[model samples]
Target: MKKRNLFLFYIVVILFFTGCVSLKDVSVYKNEEISEYKYALINSTESLTSNVGTTINGVYVSEGKTVNPRDIISGYLMKRGFIIITEISDDIKDKTLIVNYGESGRRNILFGYTTEVTLQFISAGTKNLVCSSTAEGIGDREADDIKKAITRALEAVFEE
Candidate 1:
Protein backbone atom coordinates (compact mmCIF):
# COMPACT_ATOMS: atom_id res chain seq x y z
CA MET A 1 0.00 0.00 0.00
CA LYS A 2 2.80 2.41 0.93
CA LYS A 3 4.63 1.51 -2.27
CA ARG A 4 1.57 2.27 -4.35
CA ASN A 5 1.16 5.68 -2.73
CA LEU A 6 4.82 6.48 -3.36
CA PHE A 7 4.47 5.48 -6.96
CA LEU A 8 1.47 7.74 -7.41
CA PHE A 9 3.30 10.65 -5.83
CA TYR A 10 6.21 10.25 -8.18
CA ILE A 11 3.89 10.12 -11.14
CA VAL A 12 2.19 13.31 -10.07
CA VAL A 13 5.50 15.06 -9.67
CA ILE A 14 6.59 14.00 -13.14
CA LEU A 15 3.38 15.25 -14.65
CA PHE A 16 3.72 18.64 -13.01
CA PHE A 17 7.30 19.06 -14.16
CA THR A 18 6.49 18.06 -17.69
CA GLY A 19 3.53 20.43 -17.87
CA CYS A 20 5.37 23.41 -16.45
CA VAL A 21 7.72 24.14 -19.30
CA SER A 22 6.18 25.86 -22.31
CA LEU A 23 5.82 24.40 -25.79
CA LYS A 24 7.02 26.89 -28.39
CA ASP A 25 7.20 27.09 -32.21
CA VAL A 26 9.20 29.98 -33.61
CA SER A 27 9.63 31.29 -37.16
CA VAL A 28 11.65 34.32 -38.21
CA TYR A 29 11.56 36.40 -41.40
CA LYS A 30 13.19 39.66 -42.42
CA ASN A 31 12.82 42.03 -45.35
CA GLU A 32 15.66 43.53 -47.36
CA GLU A 33 14.50 47.00 -46.39
CA ILE A 34 15.90 46.58 -42.86
CA SER A 35 17.51 49.84 -41.83
CA GLU A 36 18.58 51.62 -38.66
CA TYR A 37 15.78 51.38 -36.07
CA LYS A 38 16.60 52.85 -32.72
CA TYR A 39 13.43 52.53 -30.65
CA ALA A 40 11.23 49.48 -30.06
CA LEU A 41 7.49 49.90 -29.55
CA ILE A 42 4.94 47.29 -28.46
CA ASN A 43 1.90 47.92 -30.59
CA SER A 44 -0.65 45.44 -29.35
CA THR A 45 -1.49 42.12 -27.67
CA GLU A 46 -4.63 40.37 -28.75
CA SER A 47 -6.19 37.52 -26.75
CA LEU A 48 -8.22 34.92 -28.60
CA THR A 49 -9.06 32.43 -25.90
CA SER A 50 -10.61 32.92 -22.53
CA ASN A 51 -8.95 31.61 -19.38
CA VAL A 52 -8.94 27.81 -19.34
CA GLY A 53 -8.56 25.18 -16.65
CA THR A 54 -9.97 21.97 -15.30
CA THR A 55 -11.45 21.69 -11.81
CA ILE A 56 -8.11 20.35 -10.66
CA ASN A 57 -6.55 23.82 -10.72
CA GLY A 58 -9.16 26.61 -11.12
CA VAL A 59 -9.53 29.41 -13.63
CA TYR A 60 -6.43 31.46 -14.49
CA VAL A 61 -8.13 34.48 -15.94
CA SER A 62 -5.99 37.47 -16.74
CA GLU A 63 -6.47 40.95 -15.42
CA GLY A 64 -5.30 43.96 -17.34
CA LYS A 65 -2.34 44.12 -14.97
CA THR A 66 -1.17 40.71 -16.11
CA VAL A 67 1.51 41.24 -18.77
CA ASN A 68 2.32 43.40 -21.76
CA PRO A 69 4.59 42.78 -24.76
CA ARG A 70 6.17 46.19 -24.43
CA ASP A 71 7.39 45.46 -20.91
CA ILE A 72 8.81 42.06 -21.86
CA ILE A 73 10.60 43.12 -25.05
CA SER A 74 11.85 46.28 -23.46
CA GLY A 75 13.28 44.48 -20.46
CA TYR A 76 15.32 42.13 -22.63
CA LEU A 77 16.20 44.36 -25.58
CA MET A 78 17.66 47.03 -23.33
CA LYS A 79 20.90 45.13 -22.92
CA ARG A 80 20.94 43.96 -26.52
CA GLY A 81 21.58 47.46 -28.00
CA PHE A 82 17.94 48.41 -28.56
CA ILE A 83 16.36 51.51 -27.16
CA ILE A 84 12.98 50.60 -25.67
CA ILE A 85 10.34 53.28 -26.04
CA THR A 86 6.84 53.51 -24.63
CA GLU A 87 5.34 56.25 -26.83
CA ILE A 88 6.41 57.51 -30.22
CA SER A 89 7.96 60.93 -30.45
CA ASP A 90 8.38 62.94 -33.63
CA ASP A 91 12.14 62.34 -33.70
CA ILE A 92 11.82 58.57 -33.10
CA LYS A 93 8.74 58.00 -35.29
CA ASP A 94 10.60 57.07 -38.45
CA LYS A 95 13.22 54.92 -36.70
CA THR A 96 10.95 52.93 -34.41
CA LEU A 97 10.97 49.16 -34.08
CA ILE A 98 7.34 48.11 -33.93
CA VAL A 99 6.57 44.91 -32.06
CA ASN A 100 3.06 43.76 -32.80
CA TYR A 101 1.34 40.67 -31.46
CA GLY A 102 0.08 38.30 -34.10
CA GLU A 103 -2.40 35.80 -32.65
CA SER A 104 -3.98 35.25 -29.28
CA GLY A 105 -3.24 31.62 -28.55
CA ARG A 106 -4.26 29.29 -25.75
CA ARG A 107 -4.25 30.32 -22.14
CA ASN A 108 -3.93 27.69 -19.47
CA ILE A 109 -5.93 28.19 -16.32
CA LEU A 110 -4.97 27.45 -12.74
CA PHE A 111 -1.60 27.90 -11.11
CA GLY A 112 -0.49 30.41 -13.72
CA TYR A 113 0.36 28.21 -16.70
CA THR A 114 1.62 29.05 -20.20
CA THR A 115 0.28 31.16 -23.07
CA GLU A 116 1.56 31.40 -26.65
CA VAL A 117 2.69 34.88 -27.68
CA THR A 118 3.06 35.46 -31.41
CA LEU A 119 4.70 38.68 -32.48
CA GLN A 120 5.94 40.39 -35.63
CA PHE A 121 8.75 42.89 -35.86
CA ILE A 122 8.23 45.60 -38.42
CA SER A 123 9.97 48.76 -39.48
CA ALA A 124 7.80 51.79 -38.84
CA GLY A 125 8.91 53.70 -41.92
CA THR A 126 8.98 50.95 -44.51
CA LYS A 127 6.26 48.84 -42.87
CA ASN A 128 8.38 45.85 -43.85
CA LEU A 129 8.35 42.66 -41.91
CA VAL A 130 11.53 42.28 -39.94
CA CYS A 131 10.81 38.96 -38.22
CA SER A 132 8.03 36.93 -36.69
CA SER A 133 8.11 34.33 -33.92
CA THR A 134 5.85 32.50 -31.51
CA ALA A 135 6.90 31.72 -27.98
CA GLU A 136 5.07 30.03 -25.12
CA GLY A 137 4.95 31.15 -21.54
CA ILE A 138 2.57 32.55 -18.94
CA GLY A 139 2.79 35.50 -21.28
CA ASP A 140 0.00 37.43 -19.62
CA ARG A 141 1.46 37.08 -16.17
CA GLU A 142 4.81 35.36 -15.77
CA ALA A 143 7.69 37.80 -15.90
CA ASP A 144 10.23 35.04 -16.36
CA ASP A 145 8.62 33.67 -19.52
CA ILE A 146 8.37 37.18 -20.96
CA LYS A 147 12.08 37.71 -20.44
CA LYS A 148 12.95 34.38 -21.99
CA ALA A 149 10.76 35.07 -25.00
CA ILE A 150 12.33 38.47 -25.52
CA THR A 151 15.81 36.99 -25.33
CA ARG A 152 14.92 34.34 -27.88
CA ALA A 153 13.26 36.90 -30.16
CA LEU A 154 16.21 39.29 -30.07
CA GLU A 155 18.70 36.50 -30.65
CA ALA A 156 16.67 35.43 -33.64
CA VAL A 157 16.53 38.97 -34.98
CA PHE A 158 20.12 40.13 -34.35
CA GLU A 159 21.93 36.81 -34.54
CA GLU A 160 20.75 36.06 -38.01
Candidate 2:
Protein backbone atom coordinates (compact mmCIF):
# COMPACT_ATOMS: atom_id res chain seq x y z
CA MET A 1 0.00 0.00 0.00
CA LYS A 2 2.78 2.45 1.00
CA LYS A 3 4.71 1.76 -2.20
CA ARG A 4 1.61 2.36 -4.33
CA ASN A 5 0.91 5.70 -2.66
CA LEU A 6 4.48 6.90 -3.21
CA PHE A 7 4.41 5.95 -6.86
CA LEU A 8 1.15 7.86 -7.44
CA PHE A 9 2.56 11.00 -5.79
CA TYR A 10 5.63 10.95 -8.01
CA ILE A 11 3.51 10.52 -11.12
CA VAL A 12 1.25 13.42 -10.16
CA VAL A 13 4.24 15.73 -9.50
CA ILE A 14 5.81 14.85 -12.85
CA LEU A 15 2.57 15.55 -14.69
CA PHE A 16 2.17 18.93 -13.01
CA PHE A 17 5.72 19.98 -13.88
CA THR A 18 5.36 18.91 -17.49
CA GLY A 19 2.08 20.78 -17.88
CA CYS A 20 3.77 24.00 -16.76
CA VAL A 21 6.22 24.00 -19.71
CA SER A 22 3.68 23.92 -22.52
CA LEU A 23 5.19 26.84 -24.46
CA LYS A 24 8.60 26.47 -26.08
CA ASP A 25 11.11 29.29 -26.52
CA VAL A 26 11.13 31.08 -29.88
CA SER A 27 13.62 33.43 -31.64
CA VAL A 28 11.02 36.11 -32.53
CA TYR A 29 12.16 39.70 -32.07
CA LYS A 30 10.83 43.24 -32.46
CA ASN A 31 12.54 46.24 -34.11
CA GLU A 32 14.45 48.41 -31.63
CA GLU A 33 12.87 51.60 -33.01
CA ILE A 34 9.37 50.30 -32.46
CA SER A 35 10.13 48.94 -29.03
CA GLU A 36 11.58 52.27 -27.83
CA TYR A 37 8.74 54.48 -29.07
CA LYS A 38 6.50 55.97 -26.33
CA TYR A 39 2.75 56.59 -25.98
CA ALA A 40 0.46 58.79 -23.80
CA LEU A 41 -3.21 59.61 -22.97
CA ILE A 42 -3.90 63.32 -22.60
CA ASN A 43 -7.70 63.61 -22.42
CA SER A 44 -11.12 61.90 -22.37
CA THR A 45 -14.70 63.03 -23.15
CA GLU A 46 -16.35 61.81 -19.92
CA SER A 47 -17.89 64.47 -17.72
CA LEU A 48 -19.66 64.92 -14.37
CA THR A 49 -22.54 67.37 -14.09
CA SER A 50 -22.30 69.58 -11.04
CA ASN A 51 -25.47 68.38 -9.29
CA VAL A 52 -27.55 65.45 -10.54
CA GLY A 53 -26.50 61.81 -10.19
CA THR A 54 -26.10 59.37 -13.10
CA THR A 55 -26.38 55.65 -13.69
CA ILE A 56 -25.10 53.20 -16.33
CA ASN A 57 -26.69 49.94 -17.38
CA GLY A 58 -29.15 50.32 -14.48
CA VAL A 59 -26.38 50.77 -11.94
CA TYR A 60 -25.64 54.15 -10.38
CA VAL A 61 -22.35 55.58 -11.60
CA SER A 62 -20.29 58.61 -10.65
CA GLU A 63 -17.65 60.57 -12.58
CA GLY A 64 -14.81 62.68 -11.26
CA LYS A 65 -15.86 60.37 -8.38
CA THR A 66 -15.76 56.89 -9.88
CA VAL A 67 -13.11 56.73 -12.66
CA ASN A 68 -12.35 58.09 -16.13
CA PRO A 69 -10.36 57.11 -19.22
CA ARG A 70 -7.98 60.04 -18.91
CA ASP A 71 -6.95 58.81 -15.47
CA ILE A 72 -6.04 55.35 -16.71
CA ILE A 73 -4.36 56.54 -19.91
CA SER A 74 -2.32 59.06 -18.02
CA GLY A 75 -1.01 56.32 -15.76
CA TYR A 76 -0.27 54.07 -18.72
CA LEU A 77 1.63 56.85 -20.54
CA MET A 78 3.77 57.57 -17.50
CA LYS A 79 5.25 54.10 -17.60
CA ARG A 80 5.19 53.51 -21.39
CA GLY A 81 6.21 56.99 -22.63
CA PHE A 82 2.94 57.32 -24.52
CA ILE A 83 0.77 60.46 -24.63
CA ILE A 84 -3.03 60.34 -25.08
CA ILE A 85 -5.10 63.45 -25.76
CA THR A 86 -8.82 63.14 -25.04
CA GLU A 87 -11.83 65.29 -26.02
CA ILE A 88 -15.34 65.18 -24.64
CA SER A 89 -18.67 66.44 -25.94
CA ASP A 90 -20.56 69.15 -24.14
CA ASP A 91 -22.42 67.83 -21.08
CA ILE A 92 -25.99 66.93 -21.96
CA LYS A 93 -28.79 66.94 -19.45
CA ASP A 94 -31.81 64.67 -19.91
CA LYS A 95 -34.88 65.84 -18.04
CA THR A 96 -37.78 63.47 -17.41
CA LEU A 97 -40.77 65.22 -15.90
CA ILE A 98 -43.66 63.20 -14.55
CA VAL A 99 -46.99 64.70 -13.54
CA ASN A 100 -49.40 62.51 -11.55
CA TYR A 101 -52.68 63.49 -9.85
CA GLY A 102 -52.58 61.55 -6.60
CA GLU A 103 -55.21 61.02 -3.88
CA SER A 104 -56.88 64.20 -2.44
CA GLY A 105 -55.95 66.27 -5.49
CA ARG A 106 -52.32 65.94 -4.52
CA ARG A 107 -49.84 66.26 -7.36
CA ASN A 108 -46.91 63.89 -7.64
CA ILE A 109 -44.06 63.96 -10.16
CA LEU A 110 -40.98 65.99 -10.77
CA PHE A 111 -37.89 65.93 -12.99
CA GLY A 112 -35.85 62.72 -13.32
CA TYR A 113 -32.98 61.87 -15.66
CA THR A 114 -29.29 61.16 -16.12
CA THR A 115 -26.38 62.67 -18.03
CA GLU A 116 -24.58 61.16 -21.04
CA VAL A 117 -20.82 61.35 -21.38
CA THR A 118 -19.07 60.90 -24.71
CA LEU A 119 -15.31 60.72 -24.83
CA GLN A 120 -12.98 60.61 -27.85
CA PHE A 121 -9.32 59.72 -27.97
CA ILE A 122 -8.82 62.68 -30.29
CA SER A 123 -5.00 62.81 -30.52
CA ALA A 124 -1.73 61.11 -29.72
CA GLY A 125 1.85 62.43 -29.63
CA THR A 126 5.22 60.85 -30.24
CA LYS A 127 8.72 62.32 -30.25
CA ASN A 128 8.40 63.53 -33.86
CA LEU A 129 4.79 62.93 -34.86
CA VAL A 130 1.23 63.68 -33.73
CA CYS A 131 -1.88 61.87 -34.89
CA SER A 132 -5.59 61.66 -34.10
CA SER A 133 -7.65 58.66 -33.06
CA THR A 134 -11.37 58.79 -32.28
CA ALA A 135 -12.85 56.86 -29.33
CA GLU A 136 -16.33 57.81 -28.18
CA GLY A 137 -18.56 56.35 -25.46
CA ILE A 138 -22.06 57.22 -24.26
CA GLY A 139 -23.72 57.03 -20.84
CA ASP A 140 -21.94 54.78 -18.39
CA ARG A 141 -19.52 53.20 -20.82
CA GLU A 142 -17.62 50.16 -19.63
CA ALA A 143 -14.19 50.90 -18.24
CA ASP A 144 -12.63 47.85 -19.87
CA ASP A 145 -14.03 48.80 -23.28
CA ILE A 146 -12.55 52.26 -23.04
CA LYS A 147 -9.23 50.80 -21.99
CA LYS A 148 -9.26 48.39 -24.90
CA ALA A 149 -9.97 51.22 -27.37
CA ILE A 150 -7.19 53.32 -25.91
CA THR A 151 -4.78 50.42 -26.20
CA ARG A 152 -5.73 49.67 -29.80
CA ALA A 153 -5.38 53.33 -30.74
CA LEU A 154 -1.97 53.53 -29.14
CA GLU A 155 -0.86 50.38 -30.91
CA ALA A 156 -2.04 51.73 -34.23
CA VAL A 157 -0.07 54.93 -33.80
CA PHE A 158 3.05 53.04 -32.82
CA GLU A 159 2.81 50.82 -35.89
CA GLU A 160 2.57 53.93 -38.10
Candidate 3:
Protein backbone atom coordinates (compact mmCIF):
# COMPACT_ATOMS: atom_id res chain seq x y z
CA MET A 1 0.00 0.00 0.00
CA LYS A 2 2.86 2.36 0.85
CA LYS A 3 4.57 1.65 -2.49
CA ARG A 4 1.34 2.32 -4.38
CA ASN A 5 0.84 5.59 -2.59
CA LEU A 6 4.42 6.62 -3.36
CA PHE A 7 3.84 5.87 -7.03
CA LEU A 8 0.68 8.00 -7.01
CA PHE A 9 2.55 10.84 -5.34
CA TYR A 10 5.29 10.69 -7.98
CA ILE A 11 2.71 10.78 -10.75
CA VAL A 12 1.02 13.84 -9.31
CA VAL A 13 4.36 15.64 -8.95
CA ILE A 14 5.27 14.87 -12.55
CA LEU A 15 1.94 16.14 -13.80
CA PHE A 16 2.23 19.35 -11.78
CA PHE A 17 5.72 20.12 -13.05
CA THR A 18 4.96 19.23 -16.63
CA GLY A 19 1.97 21.59 -16.74
CA CYS A 20 4.24 24.64 -16.47
CA VAL A 21 5.71 24.14 -19.97
CA SER A 22 2.34 23.96 -21.69
CA LEU A 23 1.32 27.24 -23.39
CA LYS A 24 -2.33 26.99 -22.42
CA ASP A 25 -2.82 30.70 -21.72
CA VAL A 26 -1.87 31.57 -25.27
CA SER A 27 -4.11 29.02 -26.91
CA VAL A 28 -7.26 31.06 -26.41
CA TYR A 29 -6.13 33.61 -29.01
CA LYS A 30 -5.47 31.04 -31.73
CA ASN A 31 -8.62 31.70 -33.74
CA GLU A 32 -8.59 35.48 -33.39
CA GLU A 33 -7.69 37.46 -36.49
CA ILE A 34 -5.13 39.96 -35.35
CA SER A 35 -3.81 41.76 -38.39
CA GLU A 36 -2.68 44.62 -36.17
CA TYR A 37 -2.98 46.15 -32.72
CA LYS A 38 -1.78 49.06 -30.64
CA TYR A 39 1.61 49.17 -28.93
CA ALA A 40 2.03 51.04 -25.66
CA LEU A 41 5.08 50.35 -23.52
CA ILE A 42 5.19 51.63 -19.95
CA ASN A 43 8.62 50.64 -18.75
CA SER A 44 9.51 50.79 -15.06
CA THR A 45 13.27 50.52 -14.96
CA GLU A 46 13.96 51.78 -11.44
CA SER A 47 15.42 48.35 -10.59
CA LEU A 48 17.90 48.11 -13.47
CA THR A 49 20.05 50.13 -15.84
CA SER A 50 18.67 51.86 -18.90
CA ASN A 51 20.31 51.16 -22.25
CA VAL A 52 23.41 49.52 -20.79
CA GLY A 53 25.69 49.86 -23.85
CA THR A 54 24.27 53.14 -25.13
CA THR A 55 25.53 56.66 -24.55
CA ILE A 56 22.03 58.08 -24.18
CA ASN A 57 21.13 59.47 -20.76
CA GLY A 58 17.85 59.54 -18.82
CA VAL A 59 15.97 57.59 -21.43
CA TYR A 60 14.10 55.88 -18.64
CA VAL A 61 11.62 58.54 -17.75
CA SER A 62 8.97 58.54 -15.04
CA GLU A 63 6.10 56.17 -15.70
CA GLY A 64 3.43 57.90 -17.68
CA LYS A 65 0.09 58.04 -15.92
CA THR A 66 -2.01 57.67 -19.02
CA VAL A 67 -1.12 55.90 -22.26
CA ASN A 68 -3.09 56.79 -25.38
CA PRO A 69 -4.71 53.63 -26.73
CA ARG A 70 -5.25 54.98 -30.23
CA ASP A 71 -1.63 55.99 -30.63
CA ILE A 72 -0.44 52.51 -29.72
CA ILE A 73 -2.85 50.79 -32.08
CA SER A 74 -1.86 53.08 -34.91
CA GLY A 75 1.82 52.49 -34.32
CA TYR A 76 1.39 48.74 -34.07
CA LEU A 77 -0.73 48.61 -37.19
CA MET A 78 1.80 50.68 -39.10
CA LYS A 79 4.67 48.41 -38.13
CA ARG A 80 2.89 45.15 -38.91
CA GLY A 81 1.60 45.84 -42.44
CA PHE A 82 -1.84 46.95 -41.32
CA ILE A 83 -3.70 50.19 -41.70
CA ILE A 84 -5.27 51.80 -38.63
CA ILE A 85 -8.72 53.16 -39.36
CA THR A 86 -10.17 55.92 -37.28
CA GLU A 87 -13.20 53.70 -37.22
CA ILE A 88 -11.43 51.04 -35.19
CA SER A 89 -13.63 50.24 -32.26
CA ASP A 90 -12.43 50.70 -28.74
CA ASP A 91 -14.46 47.57 -28.01
CA ILE A 92 -12.39 45.14 -30.06
CA LYS A 93 -8.65 44.78 -30.59
CA ASP A 94 -8.01 47.04 -27.63
CA LYS A 95 -4.62 46.05 -26.18
CA THR A 96 -3.38 47.80 -23.08
CA LEU A 97 -0.62 46.59 -20.78
CA ILE A 98 1.16 47.90 -17.68
CA VAL A 99 4.78 46.91 -17.05
CA ASN A 100 6.51 47.22 -13.68
CA TYR A 101 9.94 46.31 -12.28
CA GLY A 102 10.69 45.47 -8.68
CA GLU A 103 13.97 44.72 -6.95
CA SER A 104 15.27 43.50 -3.57
CA GLY A 105 18.90 43.64 -2.64
CA ARG A 106 21.26 42.80 0.20
CA ARG A 107 24.24 45.01 0.88
CA ASN A 108 27.75 43.70 1.66
CA ILE A 109 27.01 40.61 -0.36
CA LEU A 110 28.90 39.56 -3.48
CA PHE A 111 25.88 39.45 -5.77
CA GLY A 112 22.59 39.75 -3.98
CA TYR A 113 19.57 41.06 -5.84
CA THR A 114 16.14 39.96 -6.97
CA THR A 115 14.26 41.63 -9.79
CA GLU A 116 11.15 41.01 -11.85
CA VAL A 117 9.17 42.50 -14.72
CA THR A 118 5.42 42.14 -14.58
CA LEU A 119 3.28 42.52 -17.73
CA GLN A 120 -0.49 42.77 -17.90
CA PHE A 121 -2.13 42.71 -21.33
CA ILE A 122 -5.85 43.27 -21.82
CA SER A 123 -7.66 43.10 -25.13
CA ALA A 124 -11.32 43.26 -25.85
CA GLY A 125 -11.09 41.66 -29.29
CA THR A 126 -11.28 37.94 -30.01
CA LYS A 127 -7.61 37.82 -29.07
CA ASN A 128 -7.69 36.87 -25.44
CA LEU A 129 -4.00 36.57 -24.70
CA VAL A 130 -1.87 37.60 -21.74
CA CYS A 131 1.81 36.99 -21.04
CA SER A 132 4.77 38.04 -18.86
CA SER A 133 8.43 37.30 -17.97
CA THR A 134 10.74 38.10 -15.04
CA ALA A 135 14.51 38.04 -14.58
CA GLU A 136 16.52 38.52 -11.40
CA GLY A 137 19.95 40.11 -11.54
CA ILE A 138 22.06 43.27 -11.11
CA GLY A 139 22.91 43.60 -14.77
CA ASP A 140 20.38 44.30 -17.53
CA ARG A 141 17.29 42.56 -16.26
CA GLU A 142 15.14 45.56 -17.02
CA ALA A 143 16.05 45.55 -20.68
CA ASP A 144 15.85 41.78 -20.76
CA ASP A 145 12.38 41.87 -19.31
CA ILE A 146 11.20 44.40 -21.88
CA LYS A 147 12.54 42.25 -24.68
CA LYS A 148 10.97 39.15 -23.26
CA ALA A 149 7.59 40.82 -22.73
CA ILE A 150 7.46 42.11 -26.27
CA THR A 151 8.46 38.72 -27.64
CA ARG A 152 5.82 37.02 -25.54
CA ALA A 153 3.15 39.50 -26.56
CA LEU A 154 3.94 39.05 -30.23
CA GLU A 155 4.08 35.30 -29.90
CA ALA A 156 0.74 35.36 -28.12
CA VAL A 157 -0.71 37.25 -31.04
CA PHE A 158 0.42 34.52 -33.45
CA GLU A 159 0.07 31.48 -31.26
CA GLU A 160 -1.96 28.50 -32.44
* lDDT of each candidate versus the true structure: 0.62, 0.36, 0.39
- Candidate 2 regions exceeding 4 Å error are 1-41, 44-66, 82-129, 135-141
Worst 10 residues of 3 by lDDT: 22-31
Model 3 off-target regions past 4 Å? 1-32, 35-77, 84-139
User: How do the residues 86-140 of candidate 2 rate in per-residue lDDT, one tens digit apiece?
Assistant: 4322231111111111011111112212221222222222123223333322122
lDDT of 2 at 86: 40
Rank list by lDDT: 1, 3, 2
Question: Of the candidates shown, which would achieve the greatest TM-score relative to the real structure?
Answer: 1
Each candidate structure's TM-score, on Cα atoms with residue i matched to residue i, is 0.58, 0.29, 0.29
As for lDDT, the candidate ahead, 2 or 3, is: 3
TM-score of model 2 vs. true structure = 0.29
Clash count of each predicted structure: 1, 13, 3
